[model samples]
Every structure is written in structure tokens, then in C-alpha cells.
Target chain A: MEKEQQKRAIEALLFLSEEPVKTDKVAAALSTTSVEAEKMIEELQEELSAQGRGLQIFEAAGGYQMGTRPDLSSFLEKAFSEEVSSNLSTAALEVLAIVAYKQPVTRIEIESIRGVRSQHVLDNLLKRKLIKISGRKEGPGRPLLYVTTADFLKYFGLKDLGELPELEVENEGAE
Target chain B: MVEQAEYKIKLPTFEGPFDLLFHLIKKAEVDIWQVSIADITEQYLAYLQSMKELNLEIASEFLVMAATLLRLKSKLLLPRSPKFQEQDEEEELFEINTAEELFQRLEEYRAFKKAALHLRQKEEEQKKVFLRSTGGQKIMVFTQQESVYTIWEGAHHLSEIMQRFAKIAAQREYVPAFSAVEDFVIARKADYIYAVLRQKRRSVPMKDFVIESSLWEVIITFIALLEMSRQRKVNLLQDRPFEPILVSLIEKQPELFQPEEGESGERTAKESY
Candidate 1:
């Protein structure tokens, strides 16, 4: 009976949380060990799957959250009544590509490559959370370093930085 | 039979109106400051007539420039009152010098084009280097068995180390405030996965445990994860690649069992890797 309650608690936690909930936090909240919570969560996951519900539990950012099942994306899209559009202009795309390739790079470096003021483009990418200011570089002006975000990887279908296309110089003479 | 036309009229094509003007100026050997407008206008029209016969698509911009030259020529040809001429000398000079601005703008455009080409070449070169370095490295590990607990633990460990380092670094006057742990945590996601996998366990959770971390510690943690993954000391699992990559330590590699490093270099065995 206690085990069944713990399983229900895991299900409840997964349902109520807005963000992915860590197992440790869930275990602590339910006054149980993480190992026990893991087992219960697994059982609850199977039960939820067996019910053929629209929602399914998935791990993200080191926690479990109840999210819409992938198979039901089309139905969810209709229900949401909005399409997410990412219409980046050529200039914005160029800036984003530069940041992705030479990450932890400064604005000056980005400008040098683009040969134009990238302030507006950088601002837009930052606003969209596609790229972010990783930190400031140690220099005279302390320029901020830019890097691509997790959303960027997810959007581009990349697993990691190493997955980014290799840049190659074919003709040294032309340069 | 078409080849039987005995006389073929050869038409002269100037590179552009500017080229024709330069040619006329050179032939006349006249100073541009005191150019004879009537003579240049005649030469320009002749070139335009020749272009018309060739059935080439004459752009309006070229014709507009021709009209401008004609207007300037007409003004230079008319005799003016001494007082009026004296009063309008600056205006006349400005009118004559309008072509100079066009020439300058063209020069600037050429320079910009050259610079863009050079930049593209440089970028291509840089891309080559990037590709060479990343070649044949199947570093990304995706699995379905990942749990939230492992991801949280890994992020938490890295965050604690980063916070401690940030605190120590902050004591020095020159160092800037430490970056938010979120910055390093999100950026080094692959490393996080690698770290979790270093343990014999194959799954971890996904969470925000990496909110505040120092730079050096984050790098070290990331490297440790990579080293372990490379050694096959652990395996990573996740439902999807970008979701939460869970790491499980394989039981054989006991050295991979070092506890999470704490603020004072002490290991938190009960709560760590």
C-alpha cells in the first residue's frame, strides 16, 4: 500500500510541476530514498503508458516532467493555436553562425568577421535565447563572450558542439 | 547565305559612361577643371547612338547621367553677366564636382566588395580547421534509460565546485564576478553527460542544479567526464539527445568512483559520484 502511494505521489509530482522535477527532490518531498522513488516512478511511468494518455513523463535538464507525447504533437499544435516562427534575416543568420562556430568569442571578433555593426543582430539572438553572453573576455574593454544555447542545439537538431559542421579552408591562396 | 553581307559595321562599346568621358578627356588632354562641355557631350551622344544600334538594354540610370552631363554642358556654354558669374562660381564648381562624388562612392563599393570576399575566404579557412578537429569523433551518446537523479547529481556537483572557485576568485581584486552556473552548465551539456556516465550507472535526471558554478571547476568537471566516456568507464542514456543525457557508471572502473569534489578539496562520498 505504501509503495502504491509512493507511485501515485511520483505521478502527481510529474503532473503538477511546470518544469522537470528532480528525483532527489521528489524523494525528499515524499520522505523516501531516491532509489525507492526511482522504482516507483518507473512503475508509474509504465502505468501512465498503459493508460494511453496524451501526457508522458520524460527527463530533461536532470529532472522528470510530464510532457505531451511526440505522437500527439500535431493535435497539440492545433490546440495551442499558434505556430512558433523563427524567421531570422540573412544578417542575423550570419551573426548566429559566427557565434556558434567561434563560441566564447567577443563582439569585436564577430564584427571583424561580418565587417558591419552586429549589435542589433546580437541583441535579437540574445532576446530569442538562441545565443547568450557566456561571460566577459579578459581584455582592455572586458568584451562579453557569446555562445549558442541549448535551445539552439535543439532547434538545429545537434547533440553537442562537436556535431556542428566542420569548417574547412579549401584554397589558402584565395585567402 | 547570311554570311554574304559584305560590309559589317563594327560598333565601339565604352566600358561605361565614365570610361567614355575619361577617354575623351585623355584625347583632348584638357584639364577636368576646365573641360569643354560641348565637345564631351557630342562624344557621349555618339557613344549612346552606337549602343542603341547594338540593341543592348540601356538602363535609365545611364541615360540620367547622360542628361546630367548635357545640362552641365548647356550651363557652361551660356554667357552670363559678370556679376552673376562671380556670384555663382562656387555653385558652378559644386555642379562640376558632382561626378566626383559618384566616383568616390563607386570606389567605396569596390573596397567593401573586396573586404567581403576576403572575409569569406578567411571564414572558409577557419571552417576547414574546425572540421578537421571534429572529424570522425562520435562523441554524442543518446539513450532512453536516463533518470533525473543522475543529471541532478552531476549538475549539482559541478555547480558546487564552480561556486567555491568563484568565491575564492572573487577575493582577488582583478577578477570579475563569477559567471552564473547556468551559463557553464547549459553550454557544457555534453560534458555534463560525460561526467554522469563516468559513474557505472547509466542514467541521470534533468534539472537546474547547475545555477552557479566557477569557470575552472566547470572545465575540469567537463574534461573528467570526456576522459571517462572515452575510456568506456561509463555509459550515457537519454530518451533523446538534447533532452537529459543520463550517465551510468559501469562496475569495472572503480577509479571512476571518486566522490564529488567539495569546497575544500574534501570528497562528499555519500552524496557524490
Candidate 2:
């Protein structure tokens, strides 16, 4: 394919993808190597934003995604107002913060840290697919370990868990 | 009694006993380590008494914390031996099992609560950027801007990533057998039902909405119907068991679920990379 045609084909794949499109997927579809595909992706990302296009491409969750410009949210709000937002309760956010930082952590660990019962909150997070049962711990009763989901990253607009702000623990070294 | 009821109504922010205890300590303007246990214990008991008077069923977690506070309060009542105070830092660390443990937990909760606020900010900031739906996503409107908005990722332990990511990143050739499913498919099905009801203007069999006839599509359509019914947009009726459900729109529209139209505008010029 011509370089121009290749860009168009790559754009179609990105558009079709609701989740992050891996570079390898784009490479396989284009019959190109993954390195070249990643380079093209990087170039296209710069081109899209350089033109200040309404539709923007970004690298998130270790893959590429096409989304609306954050600054242009006001203009799109009138048309997409109803689906614009769904704010979570404080309790949900607290539970999510714990699960995000100490992920693959168990419910007992979360409850002990909070000094409260978290079974109900954990169940709700599991239902929402914000957190999942990663595996069972190797200990008494073999309690299930929980970890944040991709949806959790999407919900928080994070590219990865690495994007989460560093948690400051003032007395972290307390004996 | 009236005051306690008022306080209970006003303090919905307190999700549990620790939250209430934290609130009392803050109100006293005392650091968690410095708070006089007796004062906070009395206040915590007072709040529990009010909860009892108001007939609120206190969860055992709150009661457990109450018992804990009372035990700590009794320690304050004990006469301090001079020798006990003269003990070194090692002894103080052991003493932490009884008293400082509660403070440590409270401090940990405070850190997580602060982290939650930071996450809330991230959520709000991300809300400014919207995503396109899969399949029927419209790309008609064009927006142009001069200044660039960039969000950079922070540093974290690289070893920590999803199992899925490790597989994809390590073996570049391993194409996922299928495209990972996003939540938009169900939303699309829901929209399809709206279009069908608008055109027919009569009760339609639910099975007619199932396009692929796959078990997955059947369940997806059924869930969409349930949601629409809950929102009073549609009513599902089945005259007999195992009968096809008849779905019809409610007469009064609730001014919701309006389908968005793609607007045409001057195309923003795109420069070649």
C-alpha cells in the first residue's frame, strides 16, 4: 500500500477499535513489521494533534486509541450531554484507590487498612468490573486477591497504572 | 436527642466509625497521635448513643471500634508507673500493639482518602475527553484548536502491569484470537431497539430484535429490553411462559435517550505527516 493509503488503513483499524489497538494488530493488518507500525502510529499521533483535529489519537493502556480532544469537551457536551459523565460515590472512590495502589491485594488487607468491613463495597466493585478476583492467596482460607481492571483505567482516563499519582505516606517508615 | 439526629443527617460523609472518630479528632484540633483518648471516646460513645436513640441499626464494625476505644480509654485511667515511662524506644514499640495500632490504621485510612480525592480529580479531568462508540460511531463534526493539550504518564514500577499486557508486549506475534470486547456492543443493541420501535409504532416481538440469533445476542437484547423497560421507555409483556416477549414503547416519552445526530461543518484542513 502507498504510505498515504497505509495511513488511511491504519486509521480505519484505530477507528474500529473501541479499546487500545496494539501496534502488532496494526502491523498484522498492514503486512508490516511491528516496529514500522509503531513508528507510523507515533507519526500519525503527532499529525493528528498538529492539525488540531477534533478527533485525537493517544497512547493509553499501552496501546493506541482515537478520542475527542479534551479541550473541545464543551462543544461536544451539548450533543453528547447525557452520556457525558457518571460520578462515583466517595465510598467507591476510596475502595478503588486502595485496590489501584495495592492491587492483587486481598479484601482482608483492604479491610484491615480501612478498619472497616468492605465485603459489600468489594462486591459492588466486582459487579461494575472495576475490580476482579485475580487469584487466591496462599494462606489460611485462601482468600481471593483483587486487582483493578482495564475498565478502571478507562474510567479514570489513565494510560496505565503508572499514570496514577504517587501516594504520599508521611509516616511510611513508622516502626 | 434532637441534636444527635441533626448531626446524623448532616454527616452522611461518615461511612463508618473510623470516619466519625477521625471527625471528632479533627473537630478537637488534636493530632491523631496527641488526641486525649478519653475525650474522643466520650464523644464516640455519645454519637453511638444518639444512633441508638435514632433507631439506626449500628453495624458490628462500629461496635467493635467502640469496644476498642473503651479499652484504650481504660488504659488512660491506669496510674502510670515512673518506671514504665522510663522504658526505651523498644518498649514503646511494643506498647504500640495496644494504643498506637489504632492511630496507625487511622493514618493509613487518611492517606487512602487523600488518594481518593486525587483520583476524583483525575476522573474529572478525563471527563473532558470523550470516546467514540464502536461500529456505528459517527465522525462528522470537525473541531480546530491552536494550543496543544498533552497528558504525560507518571513513573511507576514497570514490572506491575496487567497479565494481558505482558502477553501482548512479550510475544509481538501472538495476535489475540479475537478483538477484546468493549461495553459498546450492548449499547448498540439498545439503540437498535429504539430505532425499531420508532419506525413500527406498535408492539414488536423481542425475538425480532435479536439479529444474529446467537445466544449472546439474545441475552444482550434481553438486557437492553430490561433497561428500557426500567426507564419507562418500553414495556415487555409475555402472555405465557416460554412465549416471545412483546415490546412496545410507553406513550409518554421521558425526554431521555435521544439519539444524537452527526453535524456537518467546515472540514478542518489536515497537514500530512
Candidate 1 regions exceeding 4 Å error are A35-52, A83-102, A111-117, A148-175, B1-273
For model 2, how does the per-residue alpha-carbon lDDT over A115-156 read when each residue is reduced to its tens digit? 667889999989999899999999999999999998888777
Per-candidate TM-score against the hidden true structure: 0.33, 0.62
lDDT of 2 by residue, B52-88 (tens): 7677788787787887788677767877667866354
lDDT of 1 by residue, A11-71 (tens): 8777766545778999998998888887777777787789997767655445666666666
Q: Deviation in angstroms for A99 in model 1?
A: 4.2
Model 1 complex DockQ against the native = 0.01
After aligning candidate 2 to the native by TM-score, how far in Å is the CA of B129 from where it should be?
1.9
Model 2 chain A, TM-score vs. native: 0.91
